[model samples]
Target: MRTGVNLAALATIALAFPSASSAQEWGFPGLGNAEFAAITAGGPAPRRDLTGAWDPGQAGIAGGDNYFNARTVPPLTPLGKEMLSRNRPTHGPYTAKVFEGNDPLTTQGDPSGFPRILNYEFRPMRIVQTPKAVLMLYSFNQSWRIIWTDGRALPQDPDPRWFGYSVGRWEDDTTFVVETVGLTERTWLDSGGFPHSEALRVQERYRRASENVIELTVTITDPLVYAKPWISRDRLPLKKLPEETDFLEQIYAASEVTGFKQNIADKARTQ
Candidate 1:
């Protein structure tokens, strides 16, 4: 139901870094506003059936509770190493606590699932589909972005953001390609707070492999923050309306807090 407040403007802010949680008094400039804008932008409101049903392809492996469970994800190179070294936290499970938003992760903090300083970047992203656009729903920190399928151009010197601006175009019937830019260094690439500079450019290919399944392939290229292009994908089943059970409800009730235990465990080790 939101209206013309400049989708390009909102896009420029989100495609910046990882996700967020609560920035008590830290006025992170465009970050909070971008979050507000994400909640209220776009003209021709997108669809809501993305929660209907979902199917993962046979080739898709079970990413498990933690996709980066110290086993999956690509290895970090020297630049990646440098980024981590420079931003690595002093104590805790992974890095710092700045990545509770933008990053697409679960409530867990340990990306390696190992003990280290934790800069958590875990969030659950929902999907809102329509004939003209696709809205990715983020539950980690109430973060999200609007992918304009109606054809738009990227802004110059955008206001820099945590999630950045995303614009999508259909390659085929079931496939959607999205380009995102205008990010900040304040966020992480995943739950582990894997680093990425503002030069980060994200390209995603989303396709409905079947009637009830959707696959999202992401290609991240940021020469300043990464040595090679970071590639990964995710799968989700559409939560059909007829079988309406609010997944977010369950997540908040207890499942989401499961990650908080890692923080507790981290504290135990430090003591």
Candidate 2:
């Protein structure tokens, strides 16, 4: 009877303190084995250093200006053109006239998604690198995007998301290529109200130009919206911000404050 009790206690102890390999297989408390593997895999060989706060510089069609004025708008299908005609943007490439147009940003909605998020929103973003993922945190709305670098395939049936699902792979020693899909169609493609269907696929190539600069080339493909795939004319150049700078300011503060004032004015008028 004592031998049986001793054997049971040993079994319990063994289960409680699993081997390292078994622990890895079982994964961390809240994460799964696959996630653990991804997180532990580290980045590609000769990992390119892309850690920094990047500023979206200048204002033009290409540099986060109004999407409509950014060069010539991409050739749109008939449906796409109709959608563009229906959109009224309060902010233009050069100015903002909030009272004259329908600006989604003023509506306190999720305005930054995909290519639009990359556009000039007058906010800085920080890039944080980890073994399993590259995290892009935007100052606007305190938004974040995760670019998974694990050797896992994109989901076969991913749920629609505001920013879409993203998977990234290294192209060379200095460039990282990312592909995204499964985006919701409710958001505009740009501040100028460019439209896209759920079938939109965005491919982004990020090249570390130097220690202080990164260049991004974006390609948009959507058969439902455009007659052909279009590449952005401007190869966006992001300048690294100083390490001491803090990007904690709220970019959407004006919109929220104006909205509250408008509510008060409306109430007074009704009374």
Candidate 3:
């Protein structure tokens, strides 16, 4: 499969907060502000100073059940209402890759045929700092990114990206403002199987609420899709993994490759 990303948006995200306050604090549970010889051993370049391992207290709520799948509260608008009524796909300019059974151009489709969810939480989304950008390293899918703050603006003409594009600016000494746009209509927003359209805008605020606690407040807006903009807040605990490291991945169903794909093609012909 091809990966579509907006380099300019990612560039903006990668360029922020090179030297964040060295205040001996982290933002998650299962891990904490602990000393790691590896970090200090090398002047903190590969420091494991990020949030980790958490239990949201609810079954299936951990990385296993809810990745951004937290219950959202977005007030719906009229346009959003109409879109939900039919679940119609977006019809416009697209250069998306086509799968035999999936909506080739539309952003929504999974081989599972059922909605997908993250069977677990990534827990440690360690923030790795570089001079130009802040990289949020995820233990899930080894999926990570460069949050750019290079004084460059988002590109006026950007290709559609699965993750869209993201840029960040400091809101205050303790908070970061992130704005993401130009995303593909295909991604599921949460592990609980929430979906979004291409015209989505995601605004996220990273706030260090306490010495060991950080809060992520997300506001998602998509007029051509959902009935309202949605918001969710997540609290994470800082963590430490001194003895080891970890990661995860997902594999789509194989039966859909032959069975479901043919089914869709057959229906199209009779219609």
Candidate 4:
């Protein structure tokens, strides 16, 4: 219920790059390239700790298109192709007109399910590590997810969930790896509306490359959808924020979208 905010601009920010002025005020003011370089070079990486706010600036936005390495994705299975055809997304290779888009999150205010959440509109996030779990708090949708660190195996046949279940372990002194499964197929793989089945499995590698930088890579595996595993994110760099940094509230509520369609989108369409 943030009022008086320009809904069209918000849509632009989510589907494209935010205006420079808007970027400065949203989610810890993502660092410019020079600033990121300077900060990352300032200190040595700490050991086995990822507790702080992190943002990847424009890099995390995936250019508002196919999030997975678009050029490298294997041909989709027949089922995957059909699912993609059904999705009329406003961004990415198979982009459609805004009015024709049926993006669940954008049009119906649905949760921006797992993988997609990390692949699209990636904003500032805070990571809190505990003995039993790692809590990830995202600026988008004010959402959070937990990556269990208690050494439990993933569920064999779990109920589908928006964010799915996740488990994490340290691959080395500096690399933390997470695996996720049981994701609901209601969500797209990225803003491009790539489809995944409930059988999708996602792996995230978080390497603390420096005190001020964590490099992340995401790999997707879904035999039912993709012919082979492919990378969605390739070592995307996330810069650390000050401990005291605060994030802007960014939520896409149903009523707000409804209002935008009536007052902005519909009117523009008519004009």
* TM-score of candidate 1 relative to the true fold: 0.55
Across 50-75, the per-residue lDDT of candidate 3 in tens digits comes to 23322212222234323432244354
User: Residue by residue across 1-271, what tens digits does model 1's lDDT show?
Assistant: 3322234533432353123222132212122323432332223322222333111212222223433433444556677677766554322235444332223234332122101011122223356667667776443344456777777787677876756777887777767788988876666664444677778788877665543334566677888755567564544222111112132311332344455545553444431
User: Which runs in model 3 stand beyond 4 Å of their true positions?
Assistant: 1-123, 191-193, 234-244, 248-271
Q: Rank all candidate structures by their TM-score, best first, as comma-separated numbers.
A: 4, 2, 1, 3
In candidate 4, position 69 carries an lDDT of 40
Off by over 4 Å in 1: 1-79, 89-125, 130-132, 234-243, 249-271
Looking at model 2, the pairs that clash are 61-70, 64-120, 66-93
Candidate 3 global Cα RMSD: 13.3
Candidate 1, poorest ten consecutive residues by summed lDDT? 110-119
lDDT, residue 265, candidate 4: 59
TM-scores for all candidates? 0.55, 0.70, 0.53, 0.85
Between the candidate structures 3 and 4, which one is better when assessed by TM-score? 4
Local distance difference test, per candidate? 0.46, 0.62, 0.42, 0.78
lDDT of 4 by residue, 1-271 (tens): 3211134423433344333224344445455554444343225667888887787877776663435545857889999999888998877787777767788888788888899888987888889999999999988888999999999999999999999999999999999999999999999877778899999999999999876679999999999989999988888888766554578777889888777767765666532
Residue-wise C-alpha lDDT for candidate 2, range 206-234, written one tens digit per residue:
88775555678778888888888887534
Model 4's lDDT to the true fold? 0.78
